[model samples]
Structure formats: C-alpha cells, structure tokens
Target: MQLPTTDIAIQTDRLTRSFGSNVAVRELNLTVRSGEIFGLLGPNGAGKTTTIKMLTTMLPPSSGAATVAGHSILCDSIGVRKRIGYVSQMISADGALTGFENLLLFARIYNVPRRKRTQRIDETLAFMGLTEARDKLVCTYSGGMIRRLEIALSMLHRPEVLFLDEPTIGLDPAARLQVWKRLKELLETFGTTILLTTHDMEEAEELCDRIAIMKEGVIAAEGSAEELKQRAGTESMNQVFIHFAGEFSDSKPNFRDINRARRTAKRLG
Candidate 1:
C-alpha cells in the first residue's frame, strides 16, 4: 500500500526484529502523519530503540517492511537515510570541538554543499538557540546545550524527518522543557516530522501530538495523549502508561540493562 508523501512521513507494515529467540519488536504497524510529533512510549527493553534503528536504517528489520519520507526501508535504504536525521541515546557530538566546529564537521559529514555549509550551520544554531555559544567547547556545555547541539547537527542537512531515541534523557526539568520548546518551534519553522521514543510520561504528554504505548514488543494502546488518558480513564499520562503497560506482567530489567542506562545517563549528564 502506498501513501501520499504530503500526508504521511512514516509507515510500517508488520515490522519486526529479533535477536536469536528474543523478539525485540513484533508486527508493528504504525503511521506518523507529516510534520507531527509521534512518540513511542514504553519502559526499557520495550523495543522502542530497535524500531528506531530499523526506521533510521541503522538496523535492518528481520521481517516485515517500512518506509520513511516516501522511500522504502528495505528497497531504498539509502533514500530513507537521505531524508532523515537521527539522534541516538548515545552522545554524538565531539566534546573536543567547539559548537561551531562540531556543526561544521557534521555539515561536511552530511554532505551539505560547501557554499551552504556555514549558512546552514548558522541557521540551525540560531533555531536551536546555540548561536551565542557557537564558539564554546562542547565539553564546557551543559547537558541541555550538548543535546541541543546534537539536535542542531542532525538538522544541518535539512532532513524531512528526524528520529530521536530517548531525547532529553539525563537533563534537569528546566533543560528538558527548553528542548521541548525548541522541538515545538522546529515543527513550526521547518515542518519536519519527528518520531521519538521516551519512557518519560510527562515528556510524551508535553511533546507528542500522538503516542503509541508499547508493551512486550507490541502496541497496547495508541492515540493522542488526551485520547489515551480518556481511554484509560485518567488525566495523567503516567496513569495511562500504567493502565496499559504496567499491569501486563512482571520482568524487571537485568543487570545489563541497568548498566547500559547508567552509562548513557553518565555521558549525557
């Protein structure tokens, strides 16, 4: 089935992934409308990261199919990659470099035209509110500042879709809100469709236009945050999350999961 490019930025048809016997994602059929913030809400190990990897072309799906920006993830991976920008949970900016230098590096890596590189970098910095700190070393930046710079790097290429995995993971509330503000402005200014994963209920409620709640590798509920709250008979997204995902079963994250999360937080903290 084909969708009009103007209407949909992402679509998946029973997309699945597995590592040996562990099915990280199972038969995920999802659609993200153009220029909207679509969130996948779940706990750790809920397959959100795996789904993102497949959509961003970093991990090939074990089965099923998907498309981004009107390009097939299976048949036209390069095309899918070209139209999207991704910010992973791990930090990507070089701390050794100044904010401006980091953007310049990404501009080159993304193959932005030399003539447009400086202009693109400047525009992205201003949009992300990083222009004043352009010459500051990334190591000297706050967690929020580094995250914004990472976001700016992703946008330097002017991608149509941006994928975020655990965006704002280790930031303080004020910083998280700041990032959310910039993301809202990004939609208004560039009309870039955003797909993000978060375990933070407040973050989802604050930033997402629509959300899919995942449990054991599948969507248990999906709708606007308000719609979900209504469905779950509550006003809080935290309650909505618990109503759908928490009551299911028991299995705490293992030591590996705990350690991985700590490392990510340490880096971004």
Candidate 2:
C-alpha cells in the first residue's frame, strides 16, 4: 500500500555518514510516516545504528540530507530535536538517583512546567509499571525496570517521533515480550511515530508496520515481511532473509579471505 499523504515524521535523501577512512552509512534514503512503526533490520555492522543516529540528528550526515518532523537535520537541528525522542542502545540514567528522581530530572531538562511535571512523571511511572518501584534507586532496578525507565525518559516530552535502537537487545524472552507489549500500548495510546532497529526478525514482524532490510550501509530490500516472502516466492521471512543473505555474500569480501590476505600482507611487511 502507498504511504498516506498526511504528515511525514521522517524523510532522508541519500543520507551518508563516514569516519576517517571507512563509510559507515551510504545513500540511505527512507521515509517513516506519521503514526506508523518502521523497523530497520540488519545483521551486526550493517549500518542500522549509524543510519538511525543520522536520522535522530545525533550524528551529522557527511553528505545528503534529512528532515525529522518537517525540520531539517542541518538547518534546524534544535527544532528536530524538540520533536524527536531517542533511546540509544545502552540505557542512560543516573544510577545514583531513584527512578522517580531520574524521570523528574528529565522532565525539568525538557522544560516541562513545574506544575505539570509532577503529574507527567506520575503518569509515566504508572504507564511503565514503575510506580511501585519509583522510589528505588536506579542502581537497585532490574534490567527490565531500567529498560522501561529508559523508554519512559524518552517519551516524557511526548515527541512526535520516537527512535529506539535495539530495545530488546539483552532481555530474556519474557522480558522482551513485555517490552513489545508496552511499546504497542504506547503507540496505540499516543499515536507516536516510531523507528526502531532490531536484529530479531520475529520482533520486526510482530511490531513493525513496515520493514527495511539493510546490508553494507544500504537498503537491500524493503516491505512487510510477508510482502518480501511473497516476492521471493517463499513462505517465511527466514527464507527471504536466507535468499538475500546469499546474494549479499556474493558481493561483499569473504571475511575469512580478507583475514588471510591481511596476515600475508603483515608477513610481507
């Protein structure tokens, strides 16, 4: 189906980013519609996180352009930042502060009014099921609790666009499911535009309205998992992944071959 002609939460035009000698992301063009969940799926080192950073305005693009919530990444970074919330791969919180305190601090930073901050904090705490444990120091919170609080922190500002990088990266299956459920609830309740990166095919299938499969810093395929499976004449997303994986392997250097060549060059040196 064609994307709706409503507000676009994110749009990128040939977005590229590079380090000194290596390209991290290349010509990554994407659009995330308002009120939809968009998933960026790739294997490790496939530039999913790099592309996300650029889209979130955490990293400036080396070339091309992007806009978040209709604000340009280069020309209006602060405006983009105001309309977007980002959760990095690792949880960021003050271990010394209580869960409630941490959230209150963030509310202050986000410039939420003092009168409204308390109510918003309470709402988020209850929403994330952290109300009972709100007084406990972050150091005492469990992995699941910390993850929930991290998400709550990002959402406190009620941003139009939310970016989550590897949200369930190290969780148990039960915890992962709980997080997914909460994410669905949040989106349904608030109609927030979400962009997430994940290595788990099942997670993307379960949660994403659309999926983009990336490889070697560029999009390899895109569509719903079912759509991709149908196009590839397969019955499962795994089969589709396998088909694309084989194709990508043919174009990229073999890791083993590259390692052997490196050893030979070292010896010659």
Candidate 3:
C-alpha cells in the first residue's frame, strides 16, 4: 500500500532494520512536521544513524516502510533523494579544491543548468559566509568553515528538506555557535525542514522544535524541550536524558569518544 500524504514532511511506520540476530532499529515510527527542526537524540548504538541511513536510502529497511517529502522509500527512492539533502557525520568536500571549485563541481553533479550554476554557486557561498574565502583551498579552512562549505554543497540543488547527521559535532564553542547561526538563517531563508541527530543536549534544546529520545532501538520520550524536562521533573536536558535512558555509566564512551571519532575521521579523510 502507498503511504498516504499528509502535512508531515517525513513519516515512518514500523520501520525496522536488523543484522542477523541483532536488531539495530526496532519497529520505529515517527512524524516530522513540515519546516520544523526535529532532533533525534540517543546514545551510541541507539539506532539514530541506522534510522537516518534508511530514511536517506543509503540502506534499505529490513522491514516496514517510510516516506520522505511524500515519496515512498520503498517505491521511489530516487524521488526521496531528489527532494532531500544530506550532510553526513564525515565531511564531504575535496581539500585540494578551492571552496568555489567544490561547489561548482557539486552543481554540475546535481545537474544544475549551466546558465544557473554560477549564480547558484555564488549565492550559496555568500549565504554560507565563504565568499571571501571562495578562492582558498578547503585544506586551509577552519573546522567550521569546512562544515559550512559542506552544507553549501548540499544546498546547491535546493532540496526541500535537509538531513544533518551531527552537523556541529567537533567544533570549538565559537565555531559551533556560528554553525548554529547559519543553520537558523537557512531555516528562515529557505523554509527547509531539518532532521538532525546530535549528542549535544543543549544543542537539541536550543534548536529543535521537537525531539525524540531513543534507547534500545525505541523512542523513550518525545516532545518539546520544556515538555521533556517537565516529564522528567528536571530543569535541564541532560537530566531529562538521564531520566529516560538511565544514568550514563563508566562503561559507556563519553564526549572523548566523539573527539576521538573526529580525529579518526579527519585522518581517514
């Protein structure tokens, strides 16, 4: 059966994925309203990335179904890909290429018409605050600059929805704030719906219109930041996560793991 379209930008019904006896995501169902910033928060291996991979069509679901931008994931994977832009946790830019060159290349890859390609690239660079550095090689740019350039590349095709996996994961405080600022601007300027996955509690609370907290391959809690805090009887998102996912123990990796992952990704890149 075809999934019915509604006002929602994305929806899933009993979406699941498993590898042998191990289920990465179990009977997942979610609705993300159009033009809203929705955050998916979870600990490592809680199925956040697995869910994103399925929605983005990088991996097919083991069972169940989903729709993105009114296109069924099962029947129209290409349609979903055309309407959404994705920025993975790993950076997706060529360090050897100048920022402008990178955007121009993606423009061609996305099949932007030759007449409109230059205008689109220039607009994206200015929107991302990289016009001044447009001629500089990406290798010399700061962590935040690279992130912004990646986002710019994703926006080249003018996707209706943006899927961001840890968009601000490894930057310093100032750079993180700058990324947030640009994201908000994008939201306002383009009215783009965003599905974000993040480990930072404060970032989720600050940016998301609604959030779903996942644990053991299921949603443990869902609501606005204030509603979640009220339900947990706490004043902070950190405490709310603890209340829902249980306390973080020494057995689990901490923020240091995120740092290590960033370093490893950089080295691999």
After superposition, candidate 2 runs with Cα above 4 Å error: 1-5, 247-269
The better-scoring model by lDDT among 1 and 2 is 1
In candidate 1, what are the lDDT values of residues 1-269, reduced to their tens digit? Answer: 65576799999999999889888899999999998999998877788888999999889999999989999999999898889999988889999999999999888888999999888888889999998999999999999998999899888888999999888988989889989998999899899999999888889988999999888889989999999989999998888999988855443455675676678788777
Task: Put down candidate 3 lDDT per residue, 1-269, tens digits, no spaces.
Answer: 44346568899999999878878799998999887899999887788888999999999999999999999999999999889999988778999999999999998888899999989999999999999999999989988899889999998898888999988877878878888998888889998889999989989998999999998788999999999999999999999988987786322344654675677356333
| Number of clashes found in candidate 3 | 0
Per-model RMSD to reference: 1.7, 7.2, 3.2
Alpha-carbon lDDT of model 3: 0.88
Ranked by TM-score, top first: 1, 3, 2
Per-residue lDDT of model 2, residues 47-86, tens digit only: 8877888877788999999988889998998998888888
Candidate 3 Cα RMSD after full superposition onto the native fold (Å): 3.2
Best by lDDT: 1
Error of 3 at 159 (Å): 0.8
lDDT of each: 0.89, 0.82, 0.88
Error of 1 at 157 (Å): 0.6
Poorly placed runs, candidate 3 (over 4 Å): 1-6, 249-260, 264-269
